[model samples]
Target: MSEAVARHWRSGHVDVEFLPVGAGSYHWRASTPKRPPLFVTVDDLDRKPFLGADADTVYARLRSALETARALRQSGMEFVVAPIEGRDGNVLSRIGRRYALAVYPYLGEPRAFGNALTAEERVALKAMLVRLHAAPKAVASLPRSVPAEVPFRRELELALDSVNTAWEDDQYSRAARPLLAANAAAIRGWLERFDELVRISSADNVDVVITHGEPHSGNIVRSGTHFALVDWDTVGLAPRERDLWLVGGGEPQLCELYRLRWRLDDLSSSVRVLLSPHDPDGDPERALRVLRISIEREPFTRD
Candidate 1:
């Protein structure tokens, strides 16, 4: 990884140290004598976000999103923590068959995943989101437009329907099968309510804009006195409510739609993980935990 980073970024020499910071990506802190430290991120282009996309397609979307962040920062929206371009004039470097890598200027520490946003922090994020929503034209490169609905609802449905059918021979999958069977009706109810909210979202007269899909406190950085957003991987065109829902001032029904999108998306992914052949290890165990939360979450309605 160190060799790859030094070669791609045209760096003198770097000593790399692994940092378990973000999910879905491997992170490292790269130190060079002459220059300040850099944050290096490597992702498996064949997994998760790459599910339907070929490696090339997923790579293109991620690179374009990061480039858009760079352009936004250049356009004076300094809150954008964009990826640094490699010497090849690309934001990402294809490390090997399975993995893709990118470099970024190491901003300081990000907040913990469970930490809630304070009132002032919420205000700051809301103001930043307003600027982001207003400036889709700042960057010539735009990512794919996503639907108003959550991405993984179908997967959730499939998991729920597989109640009678047994999961493959795996401990977690075995446990998940009965859980799904017991909660099938409640999951369906949540889905129905979600669809109802989607109708309201579809009828609303709202402008679509560039959104940082997961701009929760975990993705925000306190830069000096103000906050800046990191992780531009989820950047895309969507209704303003998608982001405004996170910070306040969004319409009630629209906000509820997005809120469901968030929980159901996580629930669905967790269900998919459990229904599939997941081993009894770190991620699979975590999926079981998330599955519990998804069904029991207040807004989701176990009834």
Candidate 2:
């Protein structure tokens, strides 16, 4: 038994104890003076994990995130409540078979964004973003994480091919084709002007700040005075613009207003690339190409 593994299974850092949860991730039982027992999750320790990627890579990236969070914690910024590694809340702990452990401050009454954040809360959200992006060296010193950036057109094309040639899910095949056909011109235009789009998207490239790669309203938690960001697992380096993209992309009405909040002067015409049908017979290569394009969109964002 590795010492690290033994320590994690027996008793976790501080008083928090861990329990294993299956699936590419694990969970732990933890408590703090101010909060009661709660569960925190860590990614799986497999050599190759989700989406057919190396598990070690993901593990390392997550560890790096914890380190970054710790450094950020020291800077008087507290948007994210990251898990501390060891007893002293300094070192991150590696846990069971292939998992890691961290303690989350349990919410007495966890408030979801839709319920908690009103129109005013949206202002608070943007303010939190500004503070998060302005963390100076905190995010800079951390690793860069980017989604694969294959051109949206290429991805759609491949996805179309998959629909035609492969045994894919019928629903995805049917829905995506018409969507692509209708949006082909817009999609191709965005692709042809990719660089221009990037430039325009990044006009307010105020800072390449740390961000939660998967930023949906789901990841936010509401506390008394301020909102706390949970799930730092997807933390990575990204253009500050990305912090606002999902909000606008998911909700178009907010596009113009969200841009102003993030201080972006222009909004790049957006396109959602349907890489490949996620069917039983789908080609992974098509998915990979789409992944590459997603990565290319923002060169500096990496994990």
Q: Whole-model Cα lDDT per candidate?
A: 0.77, 0.49
Q: What digit string (tens of lDDT, one per residue) describes model 2 on residues 54-109?
A: 55565677677777766676677777676645555444565554665554555533
lDDT of 1 at 240: 77
- Candidate 2 to native Cα RMSD, angstroms: 8.6
| lDDT string, candidate 1, 154-222, tens digits | 778887777797667687787777877888897788788888987776665766788887788888888
Return the top candidate by TM-score: 1
Error of 1 at 93 (Å): 1.1
TM-score of each: 0.89, 0.60
What is the TM-score (0 to 1) of candidate 1?
A: 0.89
- Positional deviation of residue 188's Cα in model 2 after best superposition, in angstroms: 3.5
lDDT of 1 at 19: 89
